[model samples]
Target: MPNDFLSPADQAAAEQQQRLLAAQVVRHDQLPTTIRTVAGVDVAYAQHSDQLVAAAVLLDAATLEIRHTAVVRLGAAFPYIPGLFSFRELPPIQQALAQLPEAPDLVICDGQGLAHPRRFGLACHLGVATGLPTIGCAKTRLVGSYHALGHPRGSTAELVLDGEVVGQALRTQPGINPLFVSIGHRVSLATACHWVLRCAPTYRQPETTRAADHLVNQELHRLLAAALPPAPDGM
Candidate 1:
């Protein structure tokens, strides 16, 4: 990735671009009747450096077993803007996805989707660009408010932003913090929640997200270690 850091003027232009691209996101379900495979995508950044790694892990939808994985290391192309992170993360993620042996039936993004200020989070951007049925299962809320949810798993509350229902806060496991889920593209909110719970049979986060996060962190540590200077002969 090239560090084409956006100027102040360019950042405004990028924001406008997000507004335009958000309109193209498909809100309804356009996924296969039965999703056989799902891909999870996540990004990891190097401390004090633009270098980052993106990983995509494909899993059997039913069994939640890892099927394939791909990883790409690259530099951030755009400046770190709060709401414009997609511009910085999308390229490497797409590169990783392209390396997969087969296209996944669905993609789960470990970030926001429609639950964004511009309605164009990384999940939405990736979904629209790839025309894939995608879902956003974020660990934290970006720009939304939801009522208190039940303690039991599967409980959910509508996430409202600007007086509009954009997503939901769902409890994937009993007594655990909820995940914010939203429609990325070609998926409905209800359906998105359903698949998220299914993928997270035993954890707070989906298996897809967990697997992808692990892959990126593992690879990042390996790269950092390899780049480190050799230790002294006798410390």
Candidate 2:
């Protein structure tokens, strides 16, 4: 698919669609008692081109070891609207997910969930689209405010927005910046926080996220390099 650069009218319609679909978000724990495998999803784009890569990496939930990885290259399907990123990123991500050998027990998205202005972020959209348990583990806060957190790991503070508790600012590593975790779909905030912490035993970002990011970045770079003309006379 190519970037459409949706018209203002189309963008309005898309926002409306998001508002309508936001009602479908589950916001509870509907996952299996024992989560065997967890997948992380992320996207990377080629500079000066519509080409983008989406990566889905399935990891052993117990050990955070990579099990299966899928990467798909495609053109953007929608414009680069700030809050409407899922519209542009989800199509390729869904393709990558389908490439996986088996559906993951749960998914961790590298974006917001309920912590968006409209309360529907990439994680929420992905969960509803695939009917899978998902969590949003973002590197930064999208919408909400929280008080200071402890330097020790596992420290957390409520992320409240518009008088509602939308998510939590969780400290995954000691003395490191916290991650914004929110309930995407079919999971609770506490459970989401737990999984984020479990997947990120040493780093600020989860293993699933790190693996998927690596895959997408590598794929994007490979594709771009292949597209470049051969160096003149092998200089």
What are the lDDT scores of the predictions, listed in order? Answer: 0.91, 0.90
Residue pairs clashing, model 2: none
C-alpha lDDT of residue 227 in model 1: 86
Angstrom error of the Cα, residue 183, model 1: value is: 0.3
Stretches of candidate 2 off by over 4 Å are 1-9, 233-235
Consecutive 10-residue window with the lowest summed lDDT within model 2: 1-10
Compared with the true structure, what per-residue lDDT tens digits does model 1 show for residues 7-125? Answer: 22477888887888899999999999989999999999887778889999999998999999999999877876778878888888988998999999999998899999999998998
What candidate 1 gets wrong by more than 4 Å, as runs, is: 1-9, 233-235
